[model samples]
Target: MRRPSLLALTLLFGTSIGLAQTTVETIAEGLEHPWALAFLPDGEALVTERPGRLLRVDPQTGGRTVISGTPSVDDRGQGGLLDIELHPEFADNRLVYLTWAGECDGGNATHLGRGRLDGDRLADFETLFVAEPCVRSMKHYGSRIVFDRDGYLFMTTGDRGERDRAQDLADHNGSVLRLHDDGSIPADNPFMERSDVQPAIFSFGHRNPQGAAIHPDTGALWIHEHGPRGGDEINRPRPGANFGWPETTYGREYWGPEIGPDTLAGTIPPIHHWTPSIAPSGMAFYTGSAFPDWHGDLFIGALAGVHLAHLRLNDGHVIDEERLLTDRGRRIRAVETGPDGGIHLLTDHVNGELLRLAPAAR
Candidate 1:
């Protein structure tokens, strides 16, 4: 039964003192600034509403439906409608992939789409990838959209707030894209025979990479970014690696100072960092078993540290940091894992909620 010490299980999982034994279940609510959620192999769920709607929910009775075509996003600040997925064959290819905020020239960027759901809509929805030199600033749009183990499709761009164009590899914003699940460009990307890069660059400076996971036992491709008021990172991009944002920061400059050189010779630090900033969003890595001591652990989704950032890996580092839902003050935007293993969460305000976390029945 031994397995404690990670700061004594992070101060005994303190978040209202380890959720007073846990139970918080509010599976669905009005949702407005939702942004990303996936799980539909009949379990019913597929939400994403950063003001551009696209739901289907019904996590056992909360009920919902909208979803029609979607796309045409660009909902300003922090941009809209981001990250969602479901096609790892998706029970015979019903597809469904996303990552929004695209308007181009006069504004927004970071796009990538795919469709074929047919009931709540989204039938021929195309538009595969559009992150580029399109800066009108709504904020960095680095997204999240996994799908590897040969299915390809990586995605995550941001650095759109300029910051030296994340060391500019001729564009694709801050990079981490490796397409080819229909969005093309994966002819062995690592800068595809470089003629000055951008052939779906797979790893670049990156500065706003909202979470993206897939390392249940080393499947690789892990991420988490959004520093500034203080560096918040976590990496493993590797494929032509370069992660150094603003030159190699451990973070600074939200009116502060120090930004380049906490370590930079070629760049590639951060296996985990989070100084005063924890605005992380959407992530998962708990292998399931209904939280068998949180299986593999790693759960970020902390909009400015509002909470739910648990960590605790050992071989790959990040050894312990609990913090769940601090009494449900709510801000966690998207975090998934359900097929019954439970642990849904997705609350990013304007009246949003989707929670689930189990083990409270007594």
Candidate 2:
């Protein structure tokens, strides 16, 4: 009567995943450590390279044009240019939002910025959010952005390799933050009235959350964070709740010592956790008609497992799971559902690629 780990699940069901008849094609190639992508209204996409380049990729010709005005990034270990997202009213405003690791006092910190798309350059650029009290570490800068129905933006920040920082109210690390479109902290944020807390903090005690998405029907926020050695988590964090990480984890250290007590008081448990760590990255909810049976399912890209995971859900609970693209053996860094009922994937590497998955028979 116990749940199995991701390794067990992969071994049990990896070979049995029967995917739909799909054709895989490399749409764009030669990207350097690509991290995230955002689709434009004109059938093109803006792709981010970890070395701080932003390229506008043409869907048809597989061509790329480097967009000007991309901010300088640290580009160190697990750092660099990251998630990109377009405004909900992008068609009218032509605004794009970006998150990356920027140089701080003596280290790098996650920074979110917004700019207007004007020809091949980003004009009127402005910094939206930047983590505070940056420490000198090369890892764990959690960065992802998702917008809600009301257009408010939510973002994730990691513990910056400091476990105890997660439990601190003043540290921007290890927390989910909410802000208005123009970088102003939301007045209604849970901790806004608390003098000891950051007004932008929505939730705290998170580790390195790599992916975030808004539920289609429920409008709730869901995020996936990496664990130390195992125990990766997918949590639906409510406002002001604590998601236990170093304080309490189901994971063990890389050298085999147990983490914390594995259960901390007043912490909300993950809805689903992968014990053997899938290294889950970008995720999307399939609402497209191209895959009828897959509609309403959640798809997450895996880095360590090197597969695309599909989790079937009913009323927010995962009922079934499947893994695809295991043979390719590439680290999938980002995944998104296209407007044309197809799936777009970005492989992470020095020679990364933008891939498309479509119905083969179509």
Candidate 3:
């Protein structure tokens, strides 16, 4: 189970070598914007295609079977079937949580649902949470699901392109929200007593946070969010913390205009920042025995850059970065350590491939 360090892999092969240490094989093809992936108890994977199809992907054999009864998805720009996560007690409860953009009363809304995984199909799906009062814009529906150690569900939602709404507690936009397993707000939330900020708001001022996970050693919530043009950030979330968005950033407007002053003192600094925008998506900390030396390293999937970025940290500061999959030229969407200790990836492309990364056989 003891595998080689990424530093060792790099030193051994150097830049002249491609990602042969990581082998990518097509597990399924013809997927329309495959966004998220989750493992089943049976060793297969459930993949969510952005156009609203869910497939049970068999990693071992590269077989795919479409799961039935998926809810209708609003496939607008950057909106559709999004992140999927399994219930904490999935082995016994068989529950799954999903995020998608769905049509509400008269407009579009972000919907979170739960269902039972039943033999390659989703059954008894019920709406667990819905971003209230649907927004008109179909963009920026930042939806990712995470569960706290205590089993509370933490859902991150975007401001739906309405920047002002992020400051409005009544609106679900641009906020990290916490809810009970069945979708009720925990009274202990920072804003539970305030009527303006909804009881669910865990933190505010996030712009399109797509990657979220718990740090293995610290157990703190960590998030990766897309900045306007150049500044993509890796942030550690905390209660009542304001992560300055429109007000501050190292990025500029997409139109090539300056956003705000760069050296603002009050704005929270990113633990790590990527200039020129890698368009980061999938993020997870490496803890498996496959790479014992990389136990606390952070693995990030880069879409625009079409690479897998490894951030090596020492005492919480990023000291080095290594880019893999440059030769493959595929948008890496999700990166996770597999049950077998190999790094598994669900790529994003016309023909996305599932990849496994380890040290090249000794």
Candidate 4:
């Protein structure tokens, strides 16, 4: 269904106005809790379902092919197959990377792996990295994989519901890690020289970060994490920086007690934050040409808010915000910029759908 232009809506309802006349189209439907989307070299795309399935979908026809040789996932509450990314040299290496919750010693932990795409199967799939000191909780398995411009792979991990773990540099929980492409610790990592800290850790003290993206112009890694009662945050993690979670949060506990002060002496504050908790999921920077007026804007999927957040940025800072697709009330699980400059979104539901947003026909 085509949505009325933001300009028209503003004129009719006295709401905020936008530049482009937008159209929302359903590209595919009947997907099972689709979590992430990545466009292949060709026009087709790869989609991951929370229940451990990978599908190759044609945007034009909605035809799907179930990819084989995927790793076994825990498939428990908030734990399953998650983010997927193509190798920077995918045209040459045919490698695809994925993150999921897998069975570990104590319980399940987020794992990273990759394999070559050989026809409809993943050939020689291998597990690369697994979060340490696995716990029994089914929540907070943060696992978003992003490759930076320098070809270094970055991964996010949650505190596994163990609030104290965020402050522990010895553990991988509640941290952003940087590593070589082959899952080896990078020599230049902030913690590499310190034997007391995990060598892969780039930054620590995060909650449960689910959204990550590299800035289109600056190439900095930006992430968004969920908070308890409020205080969802968007942060640009720096090397060895501490982002105070339990020790310094704007969110109150579920039981109505304050977690901590909003800012601490040494902790880095978030660039932007949400008070009512949007429960953000996927994120992407708009560099596509289809929406010229939207260039450089950031798009994020909101699970709790059930809308797509359109954030206008100025010089790396969020200047304005607009909520898109609010009428649908679909829990948007992922957001991606299509090769054609359209916006692609994955809805979270038993019978999920892949929707595309583009400039409306004049």
Candidate 5:
């Protein structure tokens, strides 16, 4: 095996922030458009390739083994195997959940499923939820999975390029969904009693949310979505709230026309937004002690911007922002905090790389 490359540098924020010496190590390379990552109990990780392969990766050696039993996926456009997550009680149940673009009657839709991890393969894989009214469009499959503190699973769905569907409560597109671990709807779901809405919907009116993470302190779900020309946003989705996609956004059409008012009377406003579009992807809240200054900060992978965004938050509001890996120019796809307190990132490319950011030796 070849030795991994290491780059040592110091990341200095503004004058008030502390300068931290950091070292970036290439853990693995040649990953084919890796999308999401989940670490196992033994420090190995599961990575999902957009083309429908699941790989168990050894971070130390950069070796990978393809795990069998992944569901067939629609790999055209932006659709394919997406997010992977371990069950909250994974140590006991060994259950793994996944979100992917699966074939449907009309075209394809984002689907959620789970199976027990049985050595190198998944056993008894089952589909739990499918975003309804699947359409032909392959863009905007906003699929990210996270589990709340109480053990309920939360998943996001893009509008599939149909902006109107986001405003329709009957459609599953462009919404955050909540479900029990077994794929059943919870009784306290915001739309349970509403005959006109999808009962699993927790929030709606989102465009294309590709990143989601739970707040380290509040345990609230935080998600970010793409905008057309500008207006990418980070929002803390609330039950029964409308996020206002086409009807209300700070973005303009690709051809240069305003979508709508940035705010409306009834929709929930974003806590933070970006104009000119960073094209944010996977997200994580830094709770590790390796980088004390980054603890409690939010990290977002930026695809279009080609960097990792570090956001300092105060009471749910973003106060400062910094960009990491800007010199590397990699299209960051996923961001995760390793068990050892290092930050792990997956770059998006045909021959992508898995990189880790840790404190440099003094």
Candidate 6:
């Protein structure tokens, strides 16, 4: 097989790898704290604003139209619209799932909802599940969602400011939950037979997991979580695993004191960790042709670094890392791959922008 020339590759792909013209462009701006983005099969974009509205964007012109039927949100601290995901059979089902913070039993909690998408509205919507003992605090409402190969959903819940709750088996706080698509517990789940453990608990002793994705090759789950002051970690999540937080961590307290042990027994160490806190929010493994050289590499959106960080993976070890779009200085919230084989991102803050990162035009 003949390898295509740079110009030929550029012609084959929409964006060229030329140095003269940069390919990263800001498509939409002035978003109210954009949290997550899900691309439709037809190439349009569905983005969630942390303040509770969902907006759909025309891929051709970047025209944004707000979709109605969003639930009332608390929109406080770190709460509100968190993550949006499409059903595996979205093309035929028109089904989408969302995580949001809302009032539950007179307190705020993370809730999941499902709906069918109509023209510019959500129809036949229903709440799938709501967290129990709705915690009042807005911080640490871990709400990232991912699906396994068997189509089971994994939802991460934070400690809700109660640190000790992370190690408790009865509380759903600080746990990775596994459930069926329709909000039913699976019989084969890790904690299904344990009386003390909730059937929904897949793993325990976690601290605010915000980013999670399944590995393309091994099908293992990869998660990144934020720690207090420092000790941001990238971990390979395992069933019924204990990821020590509040007991063993590499982070210090916000007041400049040590929180606990630097490292302890039985707690899994991170594959990689950041010290000063990149505040990573979104992560993806590149498998697109647009950046062939970036294939199999991990890309993470850095909210505190105000840039996108790429890590080159070699046999499970991060051998190289790079930072891109540093000058733009936006709090990158989410990173996803587009249908056209391009990289897409959502920025945080009121005037957040939707950005597309691709090879520069040749």
Question: Which one wins on lDDT?
Answer: 5
Query: In candidate 1, where is summed lDDT lowest over 10 consecutive residues?
Result: 2-11
Go through the candidates in order and give each one's C-alpha lDDT: 0.82, 0.86, 0.79, 0.89, 0.91, 0.82
Question: Residue 210 error for model 2, in Å?
Answer: 0.6
Per-residue lDDT of candidate 3, residues 55-142 (tens digit): 8877666678998878889998888898899988999998888999998887788889988888867899998899876988888787
**What's the TM-score of every candidate structure?**
0.35, 0.94, 0.91, 0.95, 0.97, 0.92
Question: For residues 310-330, could you state the per-residue lDDT of candidate 5 as single tens digits?
Answer: 899998899989888898889
Model 5 misses residue 212 by how many Å?
A: 1.0
Model 6: worst 10 consecutive residues (lDDT sum): 2-11
Name the top TM-score candidate: 5
Candidate 6 local lDDT, 237-323, one digit each (tens): 778888888798888888999988877799877888888888888888887788776677788999898988878788888876767
Q: Model 3, residue 170: what's the lDDT?
A: 78
Put down candidate 2 lDDT per residue, 186-282, tens digits, no spaces.
Answer: 7889998889988888998899998998887788889999888898889997889999877888889999999887677889888888879889999
Tens digit per residue, CA lDDT, model 1, 1-362: 21121111111244322444655677777789897899887887888888789888887776788989978888878888888897889778798988888887776788989998988798999988787777888888888889988889898988878788877899888878888888989777877887987788888898888888889888998988898877889898989889889888788898888877778888889988888897898889977686687787889888877888888888899877878767667789878888888788888998898877766545
Over 182-227, each residue of candidate 4 has an lDDT whose tens digit, in order, gives 8999898998888899899999999999999999899999999998
- TM-score computed on alpha carbons, candidate 2: 0.94
Candidate 5 wrongly placed segments (more than 4 Å): 1-16
Candidate 3's TM-score reads 0.91
Q: What's the lDDT for residue 124 in model 4? A: 96
What's the residue-level lDDT of 144 in candidate 4? 91
Which ten contiguous residues of candidate 3 have the minimum total lDDT? 1-10
lDDT of 5 at 85: 98
Regions of candidate 1 where Cα sits further than 4 Å from its true position? 1-12, 17-19, 23-36, 39-43, 47-82, 85-111, 114-116, 120-122, 132-142, 145-165, 175-208, 212-246, 251-260, 263-272, 275-356
Residue ranges of candidate 2 with Cα displaced over 4 Å: 1-19
For residue 204, model 6's alpha carbon misses the true position, in angstroms, by 1.6
Residue pairs clashing in model 5 are none
Compared with the true structure, the alpha-carbon lDDT of candidate 5 equals 0.91
Candidate 4, 270: how far from true, in Å?
A: 0.5
